[model samples]
Target: MKQTWFERAIFFSWYCGIRDCAYCFMSTQPDSKKAVRSKESLLAELLLCKKLGWKIGFISGGIGAFSQTKFKDLLKDMYKVSGEKFWLNIGALTADELKEYLPYTKGVVGSIETVNERIHDKICPSKPMEPYFEMFEDVSKLGLKNAMTIILGLGETIKDFAELKNIVEKYNITKVHFYGLNPQKGTVFEKSDPPSAEYQAEWIKKTREEFPKIDIQCGIWVDRVDRVAKLLKAGANSISKFPILKKFGSKEAKEIERQAKLAGREFRGTLTKLPEIDWDGEISKLDLAEELKEKIKNKLRLYLKKMQKNYF
Candidate 1:
């Protein structure tokens, strides 16, 4: 029996200090305290991931809680030893923080979780949705790619979906990660029902329809193969995790890879390839989409004019 190497990896260096959101799996609360992993522990994990040839890494932390100094130090350490590409989800960064962090990162991400500002404020009381948008614009201007996670069943309506579409178009978010709500036992949402798999699949279809060019990472919260197939069929190009490839064994890994390919997405480990979120490229896609729409409108107008003349 041989072990498999993961091409991509999603390793959380720390539980989000920003546990303000009710759906957080780690349940990081406002008063919740978490010990920062010692620099040695973090280095060891990164080294192992690098040694295993993990191509993509998602380094995440709770909003406003992880030390920027420590994160920069970790980035410096990885650069010295490995060239594996990476993205950071160190919640609600300031523009200056984004600027400082850009050179060391392939991309940076934060979760608005929902487009409804009221829901966002209620779910993440310590942070506002405004700053995330501000930081996204700032990051884009820096020519760094940005991504956002949208958690469904978090008090959002179809109207919010329209807003989410607007945000994607307005900011040119290169990638969108869809997380089906998983209510953690100790959190505010613990008593709330999880979003139906059907609900998630429907939204996945809507998202794909609205933003055909934006890369979508779907079913990070799903574990069942049947539902995964549903999500993939609904337009999810990627599943969130296949960590078992690195930790468990081959049988399940082969199945996940097979299903991913069947869904028209490659099992490229955890994160979408760093280059997939090319900020400029995505903005160009928006431009092209708009351009094509206008061209269609123009053709329709000419056809209508010809029809009117013939009828007269």
Candidate 2:
């Protein structure tokens, strides 16, 4: 099979300080021992990603360790190597930290999973919802792109989704990651049942109606072609965890693109754009090297061609 370019990059966080979130997929917790990775190791991984032609997508972890000197040093080292290719997914950052990082960071992930304070407090006991929003506000003030994730089936309702829309509008959030809550064994929500894929399709539809201009990614939980078709029909334009890349050619990637076209949406290969925001204009504004800018422009051109081909 012919090789293809990967749309986005996803990096793992070696340390997570906020481990107690009820629905944490990684099962990180406050008392859990942190397994820190060396700065050299992370930088090497970033280099590998670049070699593979993957765009800086998003890096996730319990970034609370960044508050400590060691993790901060590791991040700085990684930044030197990563440049603006990767977006940071760790939250609880201060204004000064955000400013210091603004030049090196492409974007930040402010994951306010739910708007219900009571449920939020009950589920994520250590991580307060207020500070997260405040951080998001700070991020917005700085003109940095931001994205958030909303986990469904955590006892939220349509009203909660409405509030999320308000947050996106207020913060100028560029993208939204929607996923269903899958109970992990031994976790606080282990007994909880996940919402049916059908329910998530409805939620995606509602979110699309609310934020037509913002990109919605329903790929977190969708794995099958039928589910991909349903999500795209419901208004999701992109997916995560997809194996589409310029490396190993996956038929699934092409099929999803075909399905997206059939549903009247364009599958802009992963990470070609910022995951959190509509970065069409922002990329042009960045002070990137000319060579990098050309590469980005080419990707945008290709994306436009794909979408235009469907219409013509």
Candidate 3:
């Protein structure tokens, strides 16, 4: 299969949902200082990313503090402003709810961390697996694209891989996003370690061999940046959740470009890199109320400032 690399910009709309999944940082670090971006700010950022030529946009977070009507309105407003559809990873939506989102949704992303029932129940006690499965089935029947995210090193065994394969085939899933478990500081798995590079590569290779036509993406977080070349060779056609290496002018960004060339693939898109924009000019042009526009401008300024200081 031909190899190509692209970046996806995920915008967080809300955080700290009601579910207290053991592995989620939102659940473990409720008092953390990080603030959730307002829905208006999220819309402005999505529009800016679109203006910057990003082809894919994802709206991610828990279904926290949003009434059914409000969530639907948010989606409707996002599409109306950006004139683009976005994939959603908020949480499992019922079939009826899926229908409500279909008009503005490009696809649905499921967080099926593991197929091992025992580990899943223990790790994600509040999040039942059945809804995710049923959601995928509904997504398929609705004729929309669907993807699943799986976390490695979550006490999953080789046997779980077979189950994963069956699930993928059963749901006609076209994409699989593989993430190495990043033990959050306050989570139950805080002291645990992510899967080794070799372990990640092996499973990715097996996945490639098993599903030749499937789109496979390996996440490139801070700790796993060095594993890029091996993972590309292991058959990952795309990288997701990568840091904004370009903004720092780091050698790692150059190295990633060099490696992509060495592997004969085209690497495209910006990973969390905000482009230079006339904030005042952009905000003025938005078709939003003046108050909301000012809020978005302020939010964008703060966001850019934060990104300048942070690496991940």
The best candidate by lDDT is 3
| lDDT by residue for model 1 (1-312), tens | 111223333443445555556667655444456645444334434443453345443676555445678677667655544454467777767878876776677777767788888888888787677778888888888888888888888888766788888888888788777777777878778888867768888888898998787767764432544466677778766656554333333445445556666655545433221122232232233322455334434443443344233231
Question: Mind giving the per-residue lDDT tens digits that candidate 3 earns over 65-147?
Answer: 46667778887867766787877887888889889888888788888888888998898887888898899888888888888
In the range 97-201, model 2's lDDT, one tens digit per residue, is 778666566667777777777788888788786776788888888878778777888888777776887788887888777777767787878898877768878
lDDT of each: 0.61, 0.62, 0.73
Span of 10 residues, lowest total lDDT, candidate 2? 1-10
Better of 2 and 3 by TM-score: 3
**Model 1 C-alpha lDDT versus the unseen true structure:** 0.61
The C-alpha local distance difference test score for the whole of candidate 3 amounts to: 0.73
Candidate that beats the other on TM-score, 1 or 3, i.e. the better one? 3
Q: In candidate 1, which residue pairs clash?
A: 16-62, 17-62, 19-28
TM-score for candidate 2, residues paired by index? 0.70
